[model samples]
Target: MALMRMAVAAVVLLDLGIRSTDLEAHYTNLGVLPLHVLFERAWNPYEFSIHNMSGLWQVQALLFLAAAGFAVGLLLGWRTRLMTVLSWVMLVSLQNRNPMIAQGGDDLLRMLLFWGIFLPWGRVWSKDAEGQPAPASYTHFSAATVAYVVQIALVYVCTAFLKNAPEWTTEGTAIYYALSLDQVLMPGGRLLYPHFELMRWLTHLTYYTELLLPVLLFIPVGTAFFRTVFVVVLFSFHIGISLTLFVGLFFVINFASLMGLLPAPVLNWLERKLGPATQRCAGYLGGLRQRLPAWQLPLQVQATWRPRARKPGYALLPMLRETVLYVLVGYTIWWNLDGIIAPKYTMSEPLRWFGYQFRTDQHWGMFAPAVFKDDGWYIIEGNAANGRLYDLYRNGRPVSYEKPYSVMALHKNDRWRKYSENYLFVDNSWMRPYYCNYMLRLWHLNPRNPPLKRLDVVYMKEVSLPNYQVSEPKREVLCSCEY
Candidate 1:
């Protein structure tokens, strides 16, 4: 649990740092969704966000910095419970503020933080460890234990079940299609794309692994072995995915979640192997804990740090805790199941109400059943006041190539790439206006550029795949907007 906490917190910090570069563009009112409109349309009374309190970009930057602090506090186990809550709030708020960029990784990170709040993640390798009683040899059975295991398993199982598309199961071309797409593909994808047959076989292996491996989590016998195997296999899977896709933090977050599933025996063996070094590290951390200011010291101190023995808590404490745990566990199960059998097994209104209130509602059908077939690039044409046409994106360059050189680095993050995907279809007319205006705004903001009177959204589609042959670009005007 401690290792999991540290890993998750580390990922949180890394994610925040990456996002900090585009804090204003991604998290402020000036981004995709303005704060006032979002508050009106999607705000829940139960949810609170500091990110929404101001429209100033500086405020968002401050909030981002504060979130980074909370993540560090979580990693160090300083005021751990409070830090966990704060970290979860900031994560949810930032993601909700501009949901356009959020992906499966963000969802997984949020859920892990939610569940981490209920576990004793600060029990070891933390500054709080200096003033505490020792724990039992094995982790005891509790609602939290069950919930954590079940939640992880549910994500894998739900995804496996939702992959009913023939591309994944029958044709075994899911990975081929995934890699061939220009948007999410990394340079590694270009190198690997030619091996279509290997990708097909790997696709089948991925499906079965996702489907069957989760079952091993529930087996009581050889729990350590099963969990160890699960962690290694899933970690490797995520690493491979990371190598080929520009999926922002998704792979990292999933790798962190695997740390939580590692059994106690494995941790114990690790501790034994690292014995003297572990003690030295703990002592170093203890010394640092002592140097903390008076105000901060209390946060790192254990709940029972006094010299005198304290009376046990009232009988109702355990009962109350158990009640809350069971309630949350039941809701977690229903929430995941509903997502798996969506449209067929919808959650009851009350369940949904609670889910929205907690911001815990989730779906796990990642790249399920079918991968997108349409591969295209956006061509933004600007008609300047000087009666000259310009490619607003590439500084007046013509859109001749099937793939943009910038596609390799065009998207700020995966969310941008995913958002671009929505504009590919003719039915997604909603994107045209926003995209057109966005292009116009960019052109107008550039002092060196000529003023544009109008902008047009054009798409050039790639009709051939599985073979790298280029077809004549099928160009179509998606929409045009006056600047």
Candidate 2:
């Protein structure tokens, strides 16, 4: 649990760091999707974002800094419960600020924080522990524990059911389709792309693994062995995914989730193996800890010390936790089922308001049904005031129609990649002109740069054909903007 806390806090910090680079444009009203536009077209009535309270990038910076501080408190387990709630609140608010940048990994991360709020994960290896030794046994059972286990399992089970396509099942060509896209293909995927038989086998393996691995966690007998097996297999599975795809934070969050379920025996073995190294690092961190002041939250909750009879309401806390856990777990399962089941079985839009309100709404449909066929690259065509053409996507370079060396590198990060994908859809056509203008504004930020007369967001569209066939990319201008 301590390890999971540290891992989650670290990932939250990393997420904030990556997102801070795009602070103004992505989170503020001055950027592409202005607050007015978001409220008009995308915002939900129940959703709350402190980020929307101000349009200034300076305000966003302050929020980012505050979130980082809470995350650091979470990492150290200082006032663990309060820190967990604060961190989760900050994360949910940031995610609510922009929906376009979100993906399945973000959903999993938020859920981890949510479940962490209900667990006693700070009893050991935390500042709150104050040098108390590690727990004799690392296992515990509670309503929160059951809720967490179910949450992780539901991710894979729902995704697998959603992928009821022939390519994923008997046809066994899903990996081929996934790797065919030059935009997301990594070196490992490219190396394995040529082997049709291997890809077919991997496709089958992936489907079954997602479908079956979670079942191992629920077996009542030999729980330790079953959990060990699940962790080892899923760890390797995510490693393969990281090597073959550019799924930012997806594997990291999964690794953190799995860390919580590791049995005490396996943890003991690892502790013995790495004790010396851990001690050395600990000494270094200990020295740093002394140099730094202790973290204190701005507001602290005061407990009543008056000598009063134990109240019945106080005694109901455990039952309350259990009731809340079961209710939430059931709701989450229903939410996942609604996404995977037939339309008639799904919940109505009004019924799903709670999920969106709390940001528990998730879609794990990654490469589902069938792999995406429309794979392509973008070209930010800019016409300079000097009558020269520059590819602003390449930072105002000489216009070149040739394909980039790595299409994946064209995206600054996973959020940008997600936004780009959304930009391609006709449903999101309202976003294109704003994005074109954003690129134009970005390119002219430097006074010495050549001014742009106009900008065009062009996509070199190529549809991946099965059986090793390739189609020529057709130039499609998605948006054209002039100053």
Steric overlap count per candidate: 1, 0
Which 10-residue span in candidate 2 carries the lowest summed lDDT? 292-301
Compared with the true structure, model 1 gives a TM-score of 0.86
Clashing pairs in 1: 165-369
Task: Judging by TM-score against the true structure, name the best candidate.
Answer: 2
lDDT of 2 by residue, 173-225 (tens): 99999998887888999899999999999999999999888999899999989
lDDT of all the models against the reference?
0.76, 0.86
Q: Model 1: residues >4 Å from true position, as ranges?
A: 36-48, 268-313, 339-345, 395-402, 423-432, 463-472
Could you tell me the C-alpha RMSD of candidate 1 in Å? 4.6
